[model samples]
Target: MKHVRLLILLSLAGPAAGAEGGPLVLTDLAGAYAPGSLPAGGGWLALECGPAGCALRSTRLQLSRKTVLHLDEFRVPLEIPRVKGSPLALLHGLALSPGPVTRWHGAGKDVDRVADQLRRRGRWTVPGDARQLALSWVRLPEQGGFRYHLGDGTTRQFLFATAFEGHYGGDTTPRVRWAGDLDGDGRADLLLSLPDDNCGFDDRLYLSSLAGPGQLVGLAARFAGRYPACGC
Candidate 1:
């Protein structure tokens, strides 16, 4: 079967409310995608909008069509927003990797000590056939997001962190879990809980954003159920 990568723009019912009467709608805009071409197994869908009004109405980016025979990687030349005043060029396609694991402490030790200790306890193993590991930390009564440290236990490292969107901060320790290949080369994704929320629906999944061994995307989507028992 020949796989064709399609771009679908879907809009919820009702007229898209915008400054104007209706929002600019963009539907089934097919880009230069090789039909029957398989996309990167662990890749992501990149949404691009031109410099103008835009809205999606029941459209889907059918990347599955690009995967015909054997599974492969999907690389789409998506034109995304450059800097405030930079020339626009085709940015590399979005790639997907395993997620990150999170960990919180109860002893209330300092963050520096916790990170260092986790680094010391970092485990290295080649699962399946991939290489790379990331270490992230979540400190309570302070920040909500984790600091992502990329690279092996050796040297030369890259580090970054994703803080909460707004002032809503953390007051308690967040129990973290690792999601990735257990015996392979995939990274571990994470599922976290935010008990501080009074409403009880603070659980969320941090999806992989960047296409690398270690790089955590912001809150993918909220998880089901309200906040469960604090500990995990």
Candidate 2:
């Protein structure tokens, strides 16, 4: 393990080719195997088939390391292999201004690092600023995306959508939501609204564990928010 860490540090010299083709100082860490929950929520994570583990990293080089763990019965053989590699951000980090990305080296290094990078890349607004940020994967108006709105100087705008090119009306948007303490833990929980038939979709409520500023620990669907007629 020590040797692997050394190699990772050594590879931090020049920009390495990212999974998306961008040049970055990639790390050299192997997948971590264990039984854990999905960052998106719901049942235990099944990683025995793919890479031993998965990680979420922002464009600015911030990373959320994933660890697997088991729940329920111990009879289930959950073995995660190291093969899928690292996950790349679908969209660029939102920043406040233009400058070199900030490299956060604190306890929440990964999350902080990503936030700092977004701020540096002019991809984000003030942490608490009531600003609307749109993040997308692939080309705009052609893919899915997320929205972050600094709400009423008190709440933050949280929305996730499958369609990237359009916005939602009212709060029916599949993604407009918030992260609160659903379980009474200090950490925040995810609460998203599902779409309705008008949007050509069924509405529902989704929940997830917020690991950090923008990292989801695990995800699950709680209730049905929309019910449409069949064969519409």
Candidate 3:
């Protein structure tokens, strides 16, 4: 059987009133894999997003024999009986909510070079006129952590290190889904899946805004949470 790629966009149901006085709409729908194409004994991938732009929520999902995948931040995989011929139904289920399906753009060797430079020197250099950015995991270190970088042509700064602090194992770094002009500032913003320390496996959506001199500042209301281990 030939593997199929499923690409679906979630429609936004309009901004609802959130308790935090910010628009309550979903964001960061990422790491989606087609049911038929999943690896045997499917594993879980990170789902990161939250209500407010400042707050972050981390979660995971397992691809096993189950129906009605719960759309939340903390639900674990349940061993429900399999329902045959319903794989495509999962896409429709997600369509009930409103949000943009996670899409990555401008991810290529150039981005990899930026990541490599960041890993080695904690900085990257790009042409001064480039815009937009995307990233992908190139390799995992022997110590068990992910390796990737972010850049398109213009931006060459390491935003992940500045957002959180603490030593993340080589395999535990967050996944980069997309990067573009998210805040209408003409500068690229990042949508990252950041791992939460409490769960140690699940991840949260981190939206980092570009600041003066190519620095990244976490847009949290209070900046409270377990900081990422520094010295990556």
Candidate 4:
């Protein structure tokens, strides 16, 4: 068997524990955290967004005057910092308000009708041989160069490329970092990471409440980063 490390941030088949029992919780490290509020053990999922890339880490929270993450290999940050004043995070397991995160993969073949409807003859495919689709990224001409949709491949009205419209250049290669309800609104929100630069991805958050008319999601937040490679 090929040894598979979790090279992607927040692996699709992630651990399921406290995810299903409640609405999604996005913790703000800059704010006050109550006692016993966060998950114990290595149960927290954090996405590190830098100008060059983004990395997903599952860690245990250590509260103090500062916040420290307990990771393997004695890894840690020199100082506690916040992204854009409030770094919202997926605190625990993968469950959202309505259901679970989509375990999307690039293993399934594209439906010809869906591709033709979207009109992007790119590498269109479903998520791991399933009938339902999780994401759609179509190629564009002479501009930001891409349009993204999140759905089961029927309606492309939910365009979400605005998150990267003015933020990236030269083919903003987007990938869904995690996909599910983020704000308890019953519509699927998204955490996306893409290597528009040569190194890593710039992360973006889209929520259902922020969606425009006839849309399912809209840009709520952004985390810009870059790294040495195009992966977690």
TM-score of each: 0.26, 0.25, 0.30, 0.38
lDDT tens per residue, model 3, 1-232: 1111111111111111122332112221222222232222212222222232221112223345322332322222222213222111111111112322232222335445545554555433323224534443344445344444555555544433322233432323443333433343344444344544342222222234425455443332111122111111
User: What is residue 32's positional error in candidate 4, in angstroms?
Assistant: 24
Candidate 2 lDDT, tens digit per residue, 117-218? 533442433221123222222223434343433222343444343443234443222332333333333333333334443323221222223333553333
Q: Name the lDDT of candidate 2.
A: 0.27
lDDT for 197 (candidate 1): 38
lDDT of each: 0.29, 0.27, 0.30, 0.42
Clashes of 3: 16
lDDT of 4 by residue, 1-232 (tens): 1123333322321222123343233433443232233344455555444344333445465554333332322212222223332223544444223222333221113222433434345333443323354566665666545666666555455444532343434444454444544465555556554544434334456666777876656766553323211221
Off by over 4 Å in 1: 1-134, 138-171, 182-185, 207-219, 223-232
True-vs-predicted CA distance for residue 101, candidate 3, Å: 15
Model 4 score (lDDT) = 0.42
Clashes of each: 29, 32, 16, 13
Better of 2 and 4 by TM-score: 4
Q: After superposition, how far is residue 42 of candidate 1 from its true place, in Å?
A: 24
- All-Cα superposition RMSD per candidate: 19.8, 19.7, 16.1, 14.8
- What stretches of model 4 exceed 4 Å from their correct place? 1-134, 141-144, 151-155, 158-172, 199-201, 225-232
